[model samples]
Target: MKRMVSASAAAVSMLLAGTTHAAVVPDYQLNSSWYSNAQNAISARSTSLSADSKAKNIIVFVGDGMGISTQTAARILQGQSQANNQGGEENYLSFEHFPHSGLAKTYNTNQQTPDSAGTMTAMMSGAKTKAGVIGVSDNVNRGDCDVSSERLVSALELAASQHKATGIISTARITHATPAATYAHVSERNWEASVPEECVGKVSDIAYQLIHQAADIDVIMGGGRRNFLPEEVTDPEGSTGRRSDGNNLIEDWQNFHRTGQYVWDSEGFNAIDTSSTSKVLGLFNSSHMEYEADRDDADEPSLSAMTEKAIDILLNDTHQQQQQGFFLMVESGRIDHAHHGGNAARALQDTIEYSNAVQAAIDKLDAAGELDDTLIIVTADHSHVFTMAGYPKRGNPILGLVVGVGSEQPSLAGDNKPYTTLGYANGPGAAASFDAGVRTDLSALDTKQLDFQQQALIPSGSETHAGEDVAVFARGPQAYLIQGAIEQNVIFHAINQAADLGGNAYVAEE
Candidate 1:
C-alpha cells in the first residue's frame, strides 16, 4: 500500500538540509530511546498523517487512568445510554474520531508502571521523571526539598511567559499530581497543604507554589479548598481547612488579582460573568470533587461546565491581546480514584463525563472560530487494572452480569457462580465474601449499582496502574505528529512544535 510521508518528518528533513534548527529539548532527551524511537515511528507512519500546520491555541484533555479498555467500555456504555441505540461497542467517544491517533508508553524513569506525577510531568515538561515527583526531573530524589536546578518548565508556563493566556481544570484536587504538574514543581506530590518543618524554608508546598509562583494563570478550578483556606476558617459547605501554615491562599489569590473572583459553590460559579472576568479561581470541594455518579447534590460544577467556563474566561482576556493564543489543561481525575476503589460503574460514569468535557471544549471553540487553529489532545496519564471479558450477546447491559451469547440467564463459572462483564486483575473486590472456598454468587446482587465493586482475582487494598501504553487522540494543527507508537513525553514535543514553543522540534512562526 502506498503511504504518504509525514509532513513533520518531511519538514524536519528539509529544515535540516537548509538551516541548523535550534533545539530547546534537553540533549539527554534527544539521545534517549524514548525520543528517538518515537521520531522513527512517526516518520514511518507519516503516510496517514496530515499536512504540517501551526496552532494558535492548545487544549489538552486528560482522563486519568483511562486505559484503552476503559475507553472501549465507556464508549459502549454511552451508546447504550442513548435512545434506540445499537450495541455500545459501535459507539465512539468524542475524541476517538480525531484525524490522528496513537499509543503513548506511560512509564516513569524509576518504574515500569507509572504514577500520575511522573506521567503528567512527561506530558507537560517534555521530559520524564520519577513516579512520585511533579514538574521536576528524575535526577532529584522523590522527597528532596531543594529542586531549584531540577525543576522543569511546563507548556503552560512557557505559554504564559510569552504573554499567552493559560488555565487548568480538574475533577480532582488542583494540587493533585496531574493538574499540579502543569504549574507547580515539587519533589513530592503529597506536599499539597504543607511540607515538613525541616523542609519548609527550602521548598514551598504545592498550594503555596500555585498562589505565589503561578500568579499569571488565568483560570483555576477544581477541589482542594482545604489546601487554600486557613485551619480556623471553615468553608460554607462546612468542611474545615487543612492548612497548618494558617495561610488563606484563597484570600492571597484575590489579593494578587484585584478583579479575580474566588468561588466555592455552584451559585458563585453560575454567577460569574466570563465575558468580563479577568481571572477566576474555583474550589468546589474540600477534597477531590464528587464522582459523576454521585454528584447530583454536591453543589459543584460538572467537568463539562468547568471546561466550557475555563475556555470562555481565557478567550475574554485582553492580556492575550497579541494573538499569541492560550494553553489549557483539563483533567478528569476522579476516573482514577474510582478505578482504585474497584468500582467500574463509577469509573465508567466519570469517563463518560470526561468525554462530555472534551466535546464541550470542541463545541465552544468551534463556535468561537478558534477550533480550526486550536490543537486539542485527548489522552490518559496511565491505565488501570480494569478488564472487560465474556462473549455476551449484543445489546447486553454493559454493567450487567455476564450472560453468554446463546443463554437467557447469567453464565456460570466452573465453580458454579455467576460473574459480571467487568472485573479487575487485583483490588479490594477480590476479598468478596467467600462461602466455604467458593466465590460469592453475584447473580442475586445488582451488579449495575453505583456502589457495586467489580470482582477481582487478587486481594489488594486498591487496584494498581497497568504498565502499558495508553491511547492518544488529536485534531487540528500538527496533529499528524501523534501517529504511531510514541513516548509519553512526545506529547509535549508535539504541542511545542505545533505552537512553536521553542523546543527541539520547534517550528518557526510563519
Candidate 2:
C-alpha cells in the first residue's frame, strides 16, 4: 500500500500536527519496560534520555525460530560449506559482528512459551500482548470481534504516520502472524482471509486490513496470494484463491495506489525498476514460500534479492519525495516451518539464507554510504525446541552423526544406538517405539538428507516453541540500546527513540 499523491496535504498535516489518534495500549504497559529500558539504554551510553533521534532509516531482520543452538549449527554449516575447508566453530554469522547485542525475554502476557503474534507485537508495538492476537492489547480475548478499542500502534504505523516510507518482506505468508503484526490488528491470527460468521463484518480479515487500513505501506512482498483473490479465480501457479467473501484484496491494493505494481513471479519481480516504482506487491506463492534449499530461483526471488530490492525502492522513495528515511521489516519465515517438520537441514539452510539477507542490507547501505545513518536490528521473534547435543569434533559435519573428537566412528549411547548432532525435544522424529523402549538405529540412515527428520526424545505431531530467551543484535544509531538482558518490548522503544517516531520519547525530569 502507498499513500496517495492526492493526500499529500493531509499527510503533511498529520506529520506536523502529530497523530490524529492515540494508541490504545494501556498506560501500565507503556510505563513498563518500554520506558525503563529506553531510559536505561540512553543512560548506559551517557546520553540524554530524550536525545535527538539519529537513525534516518531502520531495517529489522527476523530469523523466525532461529535459536542460539540453531545459530551455532548454521554458523558451522556455513563455514564448512566454504571452499577453504575450515573448522566451522570460528565463523560467525554476518549479524554476529553487529557491535552490540543482547538477550530478549520472549514471553507473552498469557503464555510462558510465546507465539509469533504476541512476540512480534511486542517487538513492533512496544507492548507484550496475548499469544494469539496481533497489534492489540492483552485485554481482548482470542477470537474476539470487539477489538477496535484494544488496538496498539506499531513502529511501522508510527513511521507511516510521520510520512516515512515503510515495507515488509517475509518468506512465509504475508498474512502470517509475524509479518501481519506490523500492520494488521486482528483478535485471532487465523483470520487471514475471512473471519467466522459471527465476526464477519465486525472484524476485517488480515489480508483485507493490509489493503484498506495499512494502505500507506510502500512495499509488500511475500506468499499468500490465495488470501487476497476471489475463490473463483486461479493464480498463474494454478492454485485457487482461498477467500470466501468474494473480495479480491489484491485488486483493491492496486486500485489504492495509482503507481502500484502487482507481481506474481520472478520475471515480473526482476522487471521492476525500483528507481521509478513508487509501490510494489509481490506474492510468489499461494501459501508459505519454499525453503531456501527447495526454492526454484525462477519462480521465487531469494530473500537477499527481496531485501536488496526493498532497500532500493524505499531509498528511492525518500530521495524522490524528500521525506524521512524508510522502515523495513524482513523475515526468514520458513525457518520456523522447517523446524516444525523436524528437518534440521532445511532449517539450517534457511537460517544461512537469513544471514545472507542481513549481509545484503549491510552491503547495500554501505555502498550508498548510508550504513551509519541506518539502524539495523537482527533478532528472532522466539526460539524453537531444537537442540544440538553430544560431543562432536570441531570439524564434524553439523548435520552428520555425532562423532566424538579424534574418533571417526559415531558416538553410541548406553543403548548402543547412534544419534545425530542436531535434534528436537519433541517432534515427528521420535524414536520408533518409545513405549517398547526401542530407539531407531541411525547407522544406516543419512542424517544430512533434506527430508531426514532428526531423532527426537518425545513423539509429537509438531515441534513446540521453547520458553527461553532469544538473542537481539543491532548496529548503527541507538544500537547501544540493545545491550544487556532486556524485556522484548524494549525493542520498539529503541527504534522509536532512534527515529523519534510518534514524538513520544520519554524525557527524564531534571
Model 1 C-alpha lDDT per residue in residues 329-415, reported as the tens digit of each score: 999999999999999999999999999999999999999889999999999999998998888888788899888887899988888
* Candidate 2 residue-wise lDDT, 226-328, digit = tens: 9999899998889999998899888888788777889999999999999989789999999999899999989999999999999999888444485688899
Which lDDT value does model 2 have at 294? 93
TM-score of each: 0.91, 0.92
TM-score of structure candidate 1:
0.91
lDDT values, one for every candidate: 0.84, 0.84
